[model samples]
Target: MALLSLRGLVKRFGDTVALDHLDLDVAPGEFLTLLGGSGSGKSTLLRVVAGFETAESGAVLLEGRDIAAVPPHARPLNMMFQSYALFPHLSVAGNVAYGLKRDDVPRAERDRRVAEALALVRLQGFERRLPYRLSGGQKQRVALARALVKRPRLLLLDEPLGALDANLRERTGFELRALQRETGAAFIMVTHDQNEALALADRVAVLEAGRLVQAGPPRAVYERPATRFVAGFLGGANVLEGQPDGAGGFDCPGLAATLRAEAPVDRGTAACALRPERITLRPSPLAGANASQGVVEEVAFRGDDSLLLVRAAGGALLRVGHAEEDGAPPPRGSTVHLAWEAAAVVPLRG
Candidate 1:
């Protein structure tokens, strides 16, 4: 059975809708990441689930029971915020044991649980250390330990690694996932970072303009988006609009070429999303199926790869990913040929 479910959830802030009839389910022991931009309602959904905010309509169900009426403290879940929210005056042990004390747990049990939680987060010897003495990553782990110490049925992480440096964030993400697996607890994380979401989630749920745009495994959603917004948002794919020629192809005016679609698309005006990595660039002019000639407008050298912005014959700006081993990317203003397989073009719905 699903561990948690959101049914027809709707929330508003007087003039703007934050959640529009959103429906989502979290499987038991699953790591689900809610991904979206600011104002996309990802954070709002997490708050509603945690009972920090109540929805105007719809139900928040935990284990098939409606939890809309439950208070935050009474719910079988815990939320760890981005800020860590640690008490500067309290030691790591104190911060982690605060919940147990409030719930009137036995002193001996609280001590045992606090030790176990600290050990789970690799903060075993830091029990006496105050929050001010801990590094950013340590502080995050302290907060995580506090949330996990309660043994909640589900855990909500609101940008848990947002405050850390890129390298530390990546390492902490790995540790966080390991901790979740060790405890076998369900986790619902909210984040605007695409790479983090894709890397940590067992499944990713994308929100757009207060609506659930797409939800699936990372590879599925990244490779085959459901709409134009999803295609452009998830991976910054190149979306080209053109007329369908009724032969499983599109007449794209931007590239001044007829491109073949990987699958049959609906009739009328259609569009396709092509990822930057799918296009192969060459210095020689290559004329064939799914090919276009363009001039390199800009080049961005990432450590492992280079991103080339090419202006096609018909003024279409295409971002192409070139590997470092592909003999250093052509200089800006250099003429280039871009080509891809027919299967690389994914059809998009309006």
Candidate 2:
């Protein structure tokens, strides 16, 4: 059974619809990340699930019980906001114990739970520190401890690490995953960062315009997107517009090449998503299918890899990501051949 389920949820704000009959499920002890851009309803869905916003229709079920009418404080869940939302006047232990105190738990039990929560987040010695004295990562852990102190069945995180620096964010992501595993609590996180979503989630749910475009394991969704939008959104894929050539091939005007498809496609206006990392660059053209010659229009050298924009014969600039281990990429304006296996060509639904 699902720990939480949203069935045909609909929410709107006068002239605009924030959630459009969306449905999703969260398994117990699972970490699911909601991935989308701005105005894509990722945050709105979190708010709805936290009981801060009500849906116009559909059911919010927690372990088979409808909780749509349940008040925020009455619901057995907690939300950690992007800003951490730590109280300025409260110390670390005070903040973590706030929820327990509100529920009128016995003082002894509250203190014990607060200590455990702080220890879980690795903040055992920082109990009396003020929020201002703590670092960004420290503050984040405090907020997480506060949410976990309640031992709720479900926990919602909205951009939990968005405020940290790049290095801290990456480190914290690994810690967050470890903490979730240690506690065995189900988590539903909302993040616009693709790397964060892909790295920390057991499953990823991609949303668009208040609708779920795709939801599956990270590798499955990344390798086989259900739509063009999903392909471009999750990982920066190069979408090529083409038509079925009445054979087991696709004629893409952008590449000026008839590429072989792994599977037969329908006869109509068709499209394929090619990830940059899948293509290999060569000095000379190879005599086989799925090979094209192009000129290097631009080159960007990242620490571990390099990105090259190759202008094909048909005037399209294809982004290619080459690893540093492959040696230095060709200079700009150099002609090169690009090749990939047919399996790398992912077909997209219209």
Candidate 3:
């Protein structure tokens, strides 16, 4: 059974609907990421689950029991904020033990639990250090320790690693996932970073303007977005308009060749969305599912890979990725061949 469930949750702020009848279910020991853009209601949904915000309608249930009227303090959950939210005056031990102390846990148990939490976050020796006494990464772990010290059934992380540097954030993303699994707690994190959501989530739920647009495994959501917004928002996609050619292929007017839409296409004859990485580039033309020649319009080196924007013969701009080890691709204005398999084309409607 799912550990947490949101049924038709609705929240409004004056004229703005912060959450519009959002429904979702989070499985036990699962790390679910709530992904969205600014003001997309990702945080608002997390707040509702944390008992920090009450929805105007619907119910919030934990273990099949409604928790709508439960106060944040009384709920079996803890939220780790983006800013860490550690007390400057208190030591790491104090901050982590704050919840236990509030609940009047016995002195021995509080000490043991605090120590265990610190160890879990690899901050065992830094218990005496203040929040300002540590680096950004360490501070984040302290905040995580504090949230986990109480062993809450559910853990809410509000952009928990948003403040870390890019390299650190990447490293901590894996670490956070591991810790969540180790603790066997259902973790629901809200973030705007697509990489973070993909790397850390067991499942991802995307929101837009206070509505649940899509929810599924990270790869499923990325490879097969349900809508144009989801396809373009989760990652970079080349959306194209086309119609079925009657031969199990699509004739996209703006592209140089016919393409095939992946099965289960909502509207096989409508628009199609394909990820940039799915398109393959070749120096010479190749006969395949969808093949065309285009000039390299732009080349951007992005650390591990390079993004090549090719203007196809039909005038549509196609984006393709080349590995860093492939060396520099053909310079700008040079013609290149692009091809993608039938499985790469994700059909969409509207």
The TM-score, computed over Cα atoms with residue i paired to residue i, of candidate 3 is 0.94
Candidate 2 lands at a TM-score of 0.98
In candidate 1, what residue range of length 10 has the lowest lDDT sum?
261-270
Instruction: Please provide, for model 1 over 1-350, each residue's C-alpha lDDT reduced to its tens digit, 9 standing for 90 to 100.
Output: 89998999999999999999999999999999998888999999999999999999999989999999999999989999999899889999999999999999999999999999999999999999999888999999999999999998799999999999999999999999999999999999998889999999999999998999999999999999888888999989999988788776887888987788666655754588999999998657667558899899999999999999999888899999999988888999999888898888888875
Q: Which residue pairs clash in candidate 1?
A: none
Candidate 2 lDDT by residue in tens digits, 67-177? 999999999999999999999999999999999999999999999999999999899899999999999999999999999999987899999999999999999999999
TM-score (all chains, Cα) for each model: 0.98, 0.98, 0.94
Those runs of model 2 whose alpha carbons end farther than 4 Å from true positions after fitting are none
State in Å the error of residue 257, model 3: 2.9
Instruction: Report lDDT (CA) for all predictions.
Output: 0.91, 0.91, 0.88
Off by over 4 Å in 1: none
Model 2: which residue pairs collide? none
Residue 336 of model 2 has an lDDT of: 90
